[model samples]
Target: MAKGDDLDPKGLIEESYKIEGISTAECRSIFLDWALSYQGVSAVGIAALLARHGLGTDHHPMTITLREGLLAPHAPKRRGGRRGRVVD
Candidate 1:
């Protein structure tokens, strides 16, 4: 994927390092926002792109979050009836 198409178009990861007192919690929040922004993309692809940009290392919270997001399975939706039931 192109850099412009990345979840972090503004390079927030790089910019975060420059901030004087950025906390891990804040970074985690930012990472979540970035990850959620690109629902159309796969977690693997996103992680790879982030790694290339230097934000996908184990040392970073962003990377950890990305990995967790990738591994987490989607929850199955619950239907209201047992097997099949007519609404009428």
Candidate 2:
């Protein structure tokens, strides 16, 4: 459960912050990769990473993405399809 390896094993989040004028879309793509790479990381862990990496830049794309990820629902949302939309 090391911070560096566990939270952001690929260092995508860290690198995204380093890119000057990075776009929200790019951050989102990097975030998705980070999330899929390190599944099951708790919200608290994410908060720590945010605190460490997101320091004073509220407008930072990575910071915004991380905050959004935190706010996102834990349960997977059902997609739009007859089978998916049908209530059991």
Candidate 3:
């Protein structure tokens, strides 16, 4: 059996704050939007996030990836290899 209880956005935001690639504010805002929009699909669950994404949004949202011109914070920590290494 599963326990159905209230969800806390602040708690989740605090936890996500330790992670890279996003700030706590963005994480929290995105999460809240997901929660409010995906009402019937078990709020605060990972499944809800997928469902919300599939439904789409008003904003022209793009991923925080190379295509969007956002370099990942941890990307530079890795040693360059011959595959895509810069050379003079």
The best candidate in terms of lDDT: 2
Q: lDDT rank, highest first?
A: 2, 1, 3
- The full ranking of all candidates by TM-score, starting with the best, is 2, 1, 3
Off by over 4 Å in 3: 1-20, 41-44, 47-88
lDDT of each: 0.61, 0.81, 0.39
Query: Candidate 2, residue 16: CA error in Å?
Result: 0.5
RMSD of 1: 5.4
Give the Cα error of residue 29 in candidate 1, in Å.
1.5
The collision pairs in model 1 are none
Give the alpha carbon lDDT tens digit for every residue of 1-88 in model 1: 3244455665665565556666778877767666666555766656665666554356666555556666768898867776556655
For every model shown, what is its TM-score relative to the native structure?
A: 0.50, 0.72, 0.26
Error of 3 at 2 (Å): 32
Q: Between 1 and 3, whose TM-score is larger?
A: 1
Q: Considering summed lDDT, which 10 consecutive residues are worst modelled in model 1? A: 1-10
Off by over 4 Å in 2: 1-4, 74-88
lDDT of 3 by residue, 53-81 (tens): 32342232322211122222455565668
Q: How displaced is residue 79 in candidate 2, in Å? A: 10
lDDT of 2 by residue, 1-88 (tens): 2235667887777778779999999999988877777766558667977988988988998899889989968897677889887878
Q: Is candidate 1 or candidate 2 better by TM-score?
A: 2
